[model samples]
Target: MDETVKTPVRSFDIHDILKCLPHRYPFLLVDRIIEAHGDQSCIGIKNVTMNEPQFMGHFPGHPVMPGVLLIEGMAQTAGAFCIQAQERAPDAPPPLIYFMTIDKAKFRKPVVPGDRVEFHIERTNRRRNMWWFKGRALVDGQCVCEAEFSAMLVDTPTA
Candidate 1:
């Protein structure tokens, strides 16, 4: 007999993310996540705007999104994956994911103002505390950046 299986999709609003990550506005590259599957994968959103500080001098006449921000966005998505994965386990406090390696990073195109950058990441492997992920960022369905990175899961200590 075949059993029907469904992997529930979890959503995280800005408030939920704030609790998971120690980042604030102007630095919080990821806005929200529409779908999350613990340590497997996730889809995230980032609203870009001209009001961002880097736009001031990133280009005198033209404002271009920085590559570092793109990587940060991916990192945020990976962080979300780790956080959701831990919550799905038996019972646990908050988990803090830290970037261990960021490799094969490439910037293919320019992400400008008024653009909504979407990020998709999948966990390739998770051993003990380290997690490996392959991620890509897209704007208007066009790839803007892509990379493979690894991070460590460090649970926050409870009092």
Candidate 2:
């Protein structure tokens, strides 16, 4: 007889993302976390549309999704994964994740409205409450941007 245990895959929709992240409205770049494996990796999706506020002035006629926002979406995906992986008390407040560092960022192509950007993030290292991740942003299965970033998770202070 053989015995094995497998970790179930987790996924988060917009509502679940709202509970895991502090971002809201125009700043909430991630639309859904399609797959998560423990705290090691996850893939998030963002649907770009012309109605977004950034398109107003980012370019008068040619709108491109800012590279910085792509990086932010990556961070948010990893942050949400970390929060979801934590083993906390039922009544505990969600920890706050702060973007600490961004490195090796590169933009390969422009992401425009109607493009569905996918944020692929993988945890490269972790210590205490700090984590490091390498991420790539892809559109139509082509790499649009890539970066390595770190974040720190802080417990929410009680009032």
CA lDDT of each candidate? 0.87, 0.94
- Where does model 1 exceed 4 Å of error? 1-4, 88-93, 157-159
Worst lDDT 10-window in candidate 1? 85-94
Error of 1 at 146 (Å): 0.3
Candidate 1 Cα deviation (angstroms), residue 129: 1.3
lDDT of 2 by residue, 17-64 (tens): 998898998999999999999989999999999999999998869999
Q: What's the lDDT of the predicted structure labeled candidate 2? A: 0.94
- Quote the RMSD, in angstroms, for model 1: 2.3
Number of clashing residue pairs, candidate 2: 0
Q: How many residue pairs clash in model 1?
A: 0
